[model samples]
Target: MADPILSVRDLVTYFRPEEGVVRAVDGASFDLYPGGTLGIVGESGCGKSVTARSILRIVDRPGEVESGEILLRRDDGGIVDLAKIDPRRREMRAIRGGDIGYVFQEPMSSLSAFYTIGNQLMEAVRLHRAVTTKEARQRAVELLQLVGIPRPEQRVDAYSFELSGGLRQRVMIALALAAEPRILIADEPTTALDVTTQAQILDLIRRIQDERRLAVILITHDMGVIAEMADTVAVMYLGKVVESGPVDAIFHAPRHPYTQALLRSIPSVLAEPRSRLATIAGSIPHPYARPEGCPFHPRCARSIAGVCDRTVPVVTKLDERHEVRCVLYGRPAEAAE
Candidate 1:
């Protein structure tokens, strides 16, 4: 396996609201290689988006990365800890859009209403690359064409409101690629799109990854999307990853109770006609009132009565490249003696 271009370990991001601390990302860890896709999946409020934002140091105020190592392998073959850097520093700002490109969930909200697509793309291009206005505009047209937008020459001048949802998404991709960054963090890029458009966007991402060997961090709640696009999968519950492994391992041989429940919940064509889809019993625990022990214990059918409700489960290795945080697989700390 290639050395990880990005590695996160024991990441803990907290939101200190007046009420309490929201542990948005607690002990989340993962690695992304140069040309592979890592899918982070969970229900809404499970911290998938927060994990991505934390990596780029773009978490909104009142929410800060409390502790962790965000290691980034730079172009010069040196390693830097992104978590330690001052996010407002020029170097960190350059790293934000220069080395890593982020495609947000909603194109309509992310793109400015007053600016043309060309203007937005040009801003991205010039910010990273020393290019004149005319050159940046030319690059914008090329980017639109690269992302498979129709009539790149004309659509370059169109505002976000002038385009369809699918087109707006394509423009978002163009803007993310405007800097030619090595890594792309796509947070629910297919949200609100029709199934057809969803497939197209996924395909475009795959094609671009193949062409550029770009590493991708795809954050979504859709397991089907993860199965289709991710090389590896990380199943997050509450704020921590409960299961992680190769996509095949996660889908065919999931170990954690939460992972199993998630896979079972996926609606399938092979299911009995008119049968109800399986659903996880309860909603994720509220961040302020998070349960002790395994965070998923309340909803996990397989949770042990006394053990899972009180003691936190440590990570247990299942096999090479596969791991889970559940007592079902992990030996107790004393048992290791």
Candidate 2:
């Protein structure tokens, strides 16, 4: 197997509002191999988006990558710690869109209404590649066509608001690929689109990922999308990844209580038509007032009385490809002691 193109270790990102510090991404770790898809699944406010932003050194104001190493393997065989680099530096700017492209969750807000789609896409091309305006425009049209946007010639000149939700999404994808980056981080790529459009967007991403052989980090709450597009899975809670492994292992043999609960909550085709879907109890705790030890313990059914609430659990390996962070999987000797 090829080595990971990107490796994140013990990533801790925090947002300091006036009230208090919010641990947006607390000690989350994962790796993305070249040309492989890594799915980060969790409910809203679980740091799925923050993790992606941290990697690109684009955490908004007040949010900082406090401690961690975002090791990115460069094309020259050297590795750079993105977290330590100055975000304003030209090198970091190049890496953000040149080495790794990001498709924001919402295309409406992300795309400027003032600029035409061609102008936006061409800007990316001109920024990343040494090309004239005419060349860039041609490249932008090709990208739009590649993403399945109808009438690439005319649509490129249209404003984002002029296109439908699905077409806008396709343009966003085209913009992300304008730089031809080796990695793509898509945060909730299909949020408000219809079911058919959502499937089409997912399929488009998968197709592009294959054609480009790009390493992809797909962040979303939809397990169905993860199951369909991801080879590896990372289940996050609050701000940490509680369980991670191959998609099959995660779906069939989930070890963590939180992971089990999330899988159970997914509506199944085999279930009775009107049956109420299983749901994880309780909402995600407030950012400033996160739970004490294990973030998921409050809602975890198998949480130990004294153990889970007080003692934070470190990640334990269940196998070469599977790891879980939960007291329920503690070593037998450690439990006995």
Candidate 3:
């Protein structure tokens, strides 16, 4: 395997409000290698988006990355901890768009309504590359074409509202790629699109990854998307990864109760017609009132009585590359000792 382009270690992002501290992302960790896709899947508010924002140092006001390291391998063969950098510094700003590009979920809100798509793209290009306006405009057109927008010359001058939802998404992707980033963090890239458009967008992302050999961190709640795009999978719940392994391992042999329930919830084509999909019991606990010990224990069917409720289960290695944070996998080994 190639060296990891980005590595997140024991990340802890928190929001401190009048109510109390909300641990949005607690001890999340993962690695993204060159040309590889790492899928982060979980329910909403499970810290998937927070994890991505933390990497770019864009965890909005009132929320901050409280601990851990976000290491990015530079072109000069040196590694820098992004978490330690001052977010207001020019270097950090350069790193945001130059090294790591972000494709947000909503294009309409993310793209400026006042500016033409061409202008937005050119602004991003000029920010990272010292280019004349004419050159930036040319580059912007090229990007628009690259992302499969039709008649780039005409569409480039159109405002965000002028394009359809699918087109807007493609423009957002082009904007993110304008700087030629090493990593692309796409949060729910196919959120609101129809099935046909979703497939097209996913195909486009796959093609781009193959062509550019870019490392991608794709954050989504869709398991089907994960199976289609991810080489490795990380299943998050209550801000922590309950399972991590190869995509096949996760889909075929999920270990964590949360992971199992998630897979079960995905409707299968072979299932009895008109059958309802299985659902995991209980809602995600409120951040301020998080359950003690294992966060998923309250809803976990395989949870041990005294052991799971009283003590936090450490990550247990299931295989060479597979791991699960559950007592069901950990208790037997301890009992044998």
Candidate 4:
């Protein structure tokens, strides 16, 4: 079997606050194969953004990656442990934008207000490449065109405030691609845009991924977006990965009750009008008030006898690539008996 481009094993990220510690990412693990797209879906505060930040080792202060191994496949076929690598190391510096690009959720905040869009793109190119200023500017123009920016030369000199939301997002994509990274981590890149713009951005991401053979980590709460873009999906709840599998499996044959509930809640086109959307019974328990047994047991519709409450269920595999950390179907036979 071919090796994955990125593999995360038993990741745990916690935030220490005056209030208390919040386990933003607890024991989350997944793999990203070359040229693959992995979608992470969950509600806000479910650790979707933190998981992305943890992989890049940019967790904010008061938050620390307590444990885990993030293995990155190097060009020489070597595996580099990202967790152990120091933030100041030259290798990590090279890894951030050179190997992995990021498209942030809010284009307005992410882009500098003072700098022109062209200047940002040129700076990105110049940082990663040993090129003359003129050459870098040309590459920047090409990137804008590649991202479907209309009249790239004219938009190049525009400031963040001068561009529309969609145009700003395109510029963000253009900047992310400046280094020609192998992986793109898009953290809810389309959330703020209208429906039409959101579709355009999704289409743009697909085209870029196909063109570059990039590994994409798409983080969003919209299951519809995941169903459209993801080859595989991971469902996170209370910092833990409750279920993960092929998009089809998770969408059609979801094993965990949470996964089922989430899918049911998405408004369907074919369903009868006035049909109420199905909602999970209770809210996600607070980080400090996490339930003792299964964090999800309190809200799970299919809570099993003595399993969801007494013991934390282990992740059990339904097949080679599909697994769920729930008590229903993916539990040990001994426990099942």
Candidate 5:
């Protein structure tokens, strides 16, 4: 495999509230190769979106990347540590749209209600490219079509309220691609769409990735989405990744108890009638109230007697591409003595 286009190592993001610091993203690590789609799957409030926001340096004052490195490999082979770069720096600004694009969860929130879709898209292109308004508008229309929005020329003039949810999402994708970035971060892009629309959006993302060869980081909680689109998947729980491996490995034979619980919770079409889905017994540990040893032990069915309650387990690697942080991986012995 080629060197990763984006590498996140032990990223720790926290939010300072009146009640204490909330560890929104604690020691999350992953690498995404060029043109690879890495899915960060976790339930809501598990910090999937926080991780993405941290990568983009959009964490506000109350939240920050306290530690770790975000190394991005440039086209010229130079390594840029995104953690070190100020978000407002000219270099970082240039990189935001030029090398990395982001499609936020809510198109309505990211999109301007006051501005026309065409204007927004054209603005994104003009910010990155030194093109005339005419050229940028033309490019915006082309992108709208590429993202499957019909009547690109006409739709560009419409407001956010005028378009359907799916169409708005397509516009968001179009805007993200306006700069032709090398990496695209889709942060819950299909959340507002219906099932059929969600599938279409996922397909669009996959097609876009293949056609443009863009490295994609899909931030989603839907296991089905991860199974469908991800080459690699990271299962996050309470801001930390419990298991990360190839989609097939993690899906077929999950090593971590949390991973197993998550898989069991997914409703299956082929499941027996009247069968209740297997669910994790407890709710997610509060960010500030995370358990002493294993954060997930409180809810993990396979948790060990005393070890899981006593100390944090070290992340153990089962293979080059698979790892888990669980007491079941023999961390108990090391922590005990």
Candidate 6:
């Protein structure tokens, strides 16, 4: 494969609360190649969303990216570490929409109620491109049409609340593409939508990706969605990625216990009617009370008592593209001793 468009390495994001520090994203790493989709899958609070926010430097208050290297390949054949840039700087602002677009989980909250949809999109257009108001409006309308919004010219003037859930999501997607970014970060893009609308939105994203050849980082808990959209898969447990590989390898032969449990929990179409679904043994450990050796030892069925709880497991490569963080693949004698 060609050089990756974006690379995240040893990312650690923490939130300081009254209780203690919450390590939302701990040492999570992945690479997104140009025109390829990387899916980050895990249950809630596993730091999938925080990983996206860390790349964009948009983590909310009290939360800070403690350490990470978010290396982005620039158009000029240079690499820039987005993690080092100040979030409030003009350069960062420009890069947010111009170089890397974001489609947030909730459109209603993401879109301002006070501004018209066209107005907001036009502002984004004008901010990135030095165009006149007329040109910006035209661009906004064009984007709305591009996202399959019906009668975009008229719909551009509509408020977010005036549009249905699917339409509102379309508008959000349009806004994300306002600057023609090289990479798109979608954090739970199909949340709160009906199954049909979710499928439509997913299809829209896939079509747009193929048409534009944009690198995408899709974050979701749904393995089915991951199967449908991702070329590579990263399975996160707590704030760390326990396994990462091609989507087929992760689905058909998951290495990590958590990944196996997650796949087992998904409902299968070929299963007998009304059969009980499989589930993980326990929930994710609390951030403050994180386990000593491995974060997943508490819930993992294959955890070795002294070995799993004694030393942290380093990543072990099963193949050129597949890796897992578990003692089972590590130095067994050392772990056992």
Clashes of 6: 0
**lDDT by residue for model 4 over 1-337, one digit each (tens)?**
4688999898999999999989999999998888999999998889999989887888888998889999999878989988898866888878888888989899878899989988999999998999999999899899999999989888888898999898899899988889999899999999989999999999999999999999999999999999999998999988888899999999989998889999999998998998888998989888888887688889887887577777777898999989998766666444655
Off by more than 4 A, model 3: 331-337
Off by over 4 Å in 5: 332-337
- Which portions of model 1 show Cα errors greater than 4 Å? 334-337
**Candidate 4 — which residues are off by over 4 angstroms?**
330-337
273 in model 1: Cα distance from truth in Å? 1.6
Q: How close is candidate 1 to the true structure, as a TM-score?
A: 0.98
Off-target runs (Cα >4 Å) in candidate 6 are: 332-337
After the best TM-score superposition of candidate 4, give how far the Cα of residue 205 lies from its true spot, in angstroms: 0.4
Each model's Cα RMSD: 1.2, 1.6, 1.8, 1.7, 1.3, 1.5
Which scores greater on lDDT, model 2 or model 5? 2
TM-score of each: 0.98, 0.97, 0.97, 0.96, 0.97, 0.97
Model 4 lDDT on a 0 to 1 scale: 0.89
What are the Cα lDDT values of the candidates?
0.92, 0.91, 0.91, 0.89, 0.90, 0.92
> What TM-score does candidate 6 reach?
0.97
Count of residue pairs whose backbone atoms collide, per candidate: 0, 0, 0, 0, 1, 0
> Top model by TM-score, which number?
1
lDDT of 5 by residue, 117-165 (tens): 9999999999999999999989999999999998888998999889888
lDDT of 2: 0.91
